[model samples]
Target: MEKKTYIQAFCTIENNKIVLNGETVFESENTGFADFSKKAYQHFEIGYPKFFKMDNLSKLAFLGSELLLKAQNPNDENNTALLFANKSSSLDTDVKYQNSISDKENYFPSPAVFVYTLANICLGEISIRHQLKSENSFFIFDAFNAAFMADYANILIETQKAKNVLCGWTEFFGEDYKAFLYLVGNEGAIENTKQNLEILYNK
Candidate 1:
């Protein structure tokens, strides 16, 4: 079987910043991871209350889930999620988790804090949010490699396993974070070049 192709993508960063269909949805001051999570939810129109209460990984996942679903085909069920690349790795929540243990005389490990330790938890959080029961995988890359991403998406689609593959780079490094997601489908919008991807990222 031949591999499927890409349809649409939604990217966002710290401070209510967003890039939907290669366009900006919201732009604001970039800050620490927690604050970024709050601002990101607002961009998705999920309001502050609901946003603030969500766990760190949950927040990241929810934002990614919302973007992909918005661009999805209503009847599509053969979906897959493939998230790739880099840091902070729940550092914000980890700090809190460690603090909770040290600050208290009794010392208790927070289940919530422990959950966000793995980077893939973000993907799981998204899956739970969207009820996405398809295949999912996460990878860490030093930087966005368009070729590798394209190849991975192609493999999933060509296997006759998945009709759509949500692929991208989502990394959080301390005070900086970036999320770039593409809803890859057999039939949909196309961004067929590396230059194009780089161009979008640069802008």
Candidate 2:
């Protein structure tokens, strides 16, 4: 008999609020994603200095993953896979980098800003923090595809490629941003399914 997969924990961030496992952990009147992300890092007592240098997309995903990972505390780090997706595809940072070079008089392309032009940089940041070198991938869709994430994660687990999957949708652009991350493992309170993922994402 195959072991059934379950969602061990989840976190959602949006509208200047952070919710871990359905309970609000942090909230702020600061509507800006940068301010709210900084507040979240402070509130969680995160000591990662690199977090300060990340783009908004990376910050959003990092914070959400931090919340879920802290809750589950998975021991088999190398056996965990990261599956993340978004719609904007780093356009936020792309614009910033573009603007930096857009001025011919001030033609300066920041290496710091240029590195975050890829949406997968957030996954790299998270993987580096947790020392996770397992299977990972990032996708962009017209909208959140809960079904694809659920199926792909389960496939990895079923094939023994990974013991657990940390997956989510992190979207950030301009003044709008949202993050929904969940941990799927062999045991947990919620079964890992498309419907469950969609419900958690919507919540």
- What's the lDDT for candidate 2? 0.90
Relative to the true structure, candidate 2 reaches a TM of 0.96
Give Cα-based local distance difference scores for all models.
0.65, 0.90
Give the candidate number with the greatest TM-score.
Answer: 2
Alpha-carbon RMSD of each model:
3.2, 1.5
Off by over 4 Å in 1: 1-4, 29-36, 39-43, 47-53, 101-106, 191-195
Candidate 1 lDDT, tens digit per residue, 149-201? Answer: 77777777778567777766776644556677667767656653465556655
How many clashing pairs per prediction, in order?
Answer: 0, 0
TM, every model: 0.79, 0.96
lDDT of 2 by residue, 1-203 (tens): 25568998898999999988899989999758878888889999999999999999999999988887776555766789999999999999999999999899999998999999999999999999988999999999988898898888888899999999999899999988888999998888999888998899898
Task: Give me candidate 1's TM-score against the actual structure.
Answer: 0.79
